[model samples]
Target: MFESIKYLQKGNQKRAYQAISELDIMKHLAAYNPILCGTLPIGIDIACSDLDIIMEVDEFERFEEQVRELYGNQQNFKVKKLHIRENPVIKANFWFSGFEFELFGQALPVKEQNAYLHMVIEDAVMKRHPSIKKEVIELKEKGWKTEPAFCKVLQLEEGDPYKELINYGKNTGFI
Candidate 1:
């Protein structure tokens, strides 16, 4: 259902952020919910303490759905509406719902992304560095800044994330 659930947390920071970033990018690419939540630069600043979102349809209805899921269903995610110049792409504000995070955006074909994302997340969660996730959770609980090292291990640059995401997806069989 929700691709976010595909991420199995091994309790590492780099892994969590890797998962977060991967999912965030995937949602945006999918454009299922154009705007990603929790990524506003003008909001409360904390690299390890903010949620991000990407959305489904119109911003308003999207908001309502998120609310219903959160309060009604007891979810752990937040929201924000980001209008991206890229047509069909919307990045929004973000928040957490327990371990389940949500980010929505333009429809980017995810079959490819999912595969690579799974591999990236799988390697991080199951091998390579398992502690990154745990550290992320610990730092998150303590409300401290933490960065994902997996991207670094993979040598990913933060700018223009689409290409890297596609590579991951294609390599991993999500496509």
Candidate 2:
């Protein structure tokens, strides 16, 4: 269901749809399941929000090679290998169609990746508590990353906000 950009073609996401479609990003990265994640999808994006595309990649080297071949020549293109939560990840960043793009890949299912999970939970929270969106956007504009802003607004004062949000989602039946 996350494969298509049809939903992104409406509302504030229309520009993002145009950018991704113009670049044919999904078509080129079809081998790995790619799902658009992060602030834009959830409608809490600020002026500087970048497009975040999460992919399921079993081999970092191959993923890096493919990303390099596809976007390495783009403006400000750069790829690097890093580890998050002890899991190896390959990330590529570049500017295209007036948008900054972040391609993140890990050896985990796209649906299971933390970025995707966070987006899902954040969306649910916003849906359930509509006013939270305004607070989130304000925090984001003030340079707060999505998760930390969420934690502050939600009063999730303890534990890792990232992991705690998942649990919060479960407890609130928002996940």
Candidate 3:
């Protein structure tokens, strides 16, 4: 499976069967998230358990509920509790143990950073498309390194890069 993913990354169609098979699994899983957009983010190497989606929301009350529904509590898939990083908000992580997939995260408030991550999340969920892929690809193409990637791709003046990047990916459109 990993080899097939690598081949697809190289734009090879012969081995695309592997990537497509994985994508099929993902597409089935999509029925659960109902909020995620397009075949997760590709072109990057990730173990099945590597964090696949880290996003921000306006409220955390329903986060755990949503996570459990999307990932289930089986040994192969489970969501970690929420934690804080660099500020006074909660973030969540999930581990898709079966397929070596791990994509989970949440963002909250930050210092002097006023990003509308909550809105982005809502928009993406409502729209039902992974709208941020092109933007991420765009940022990478623009030589946007580190934190500047979000600012450049989202066309935002300033805000939390982590939240912005994740939110953009969750949304249906870049800007």
Every model: Cα RMSD to truth: 10.0, 1.1, 10.5
How accurate locally, in lDDT, is each candidate? 0.40, 0.89, 0.40
Model 3 local distance difference test score: 0.40
lDDT of 2 at 21: 88
Cand. 1 Cα-lDDT: 0.40
**Top model number, TM-score:** 2
Write down the TM-score of every candidate.
0.35, 0.96, 0.33
Over 35-145, each residue of candidate 2 has an lDDT whose tens digit, in order, gives: 899998777888899999999999888888888998999999999898898999989999998899999999899988889888889998988889999999998888998
lDDT for model 2 comes to 0.89
Model 3 stretches with alpha carbons more than 4 Å out: 1-51, 82-84, 88-98, 108-175
Which one wins by lDDT: 2 or 3? 2
- Which portions of model 2 miss their true places by more than 4 Å? none
lDDT of 3 by residue, 33-57 (tens): 3122112223322222132333344
Model 1: residues >4 Å from true position, as ranges?
A: 1-55, 62-79, 84-148, 172-175
Q: Which of the predicted structures, 1 or 2, would earn the higher TM-score when compared with the native?
A: 2
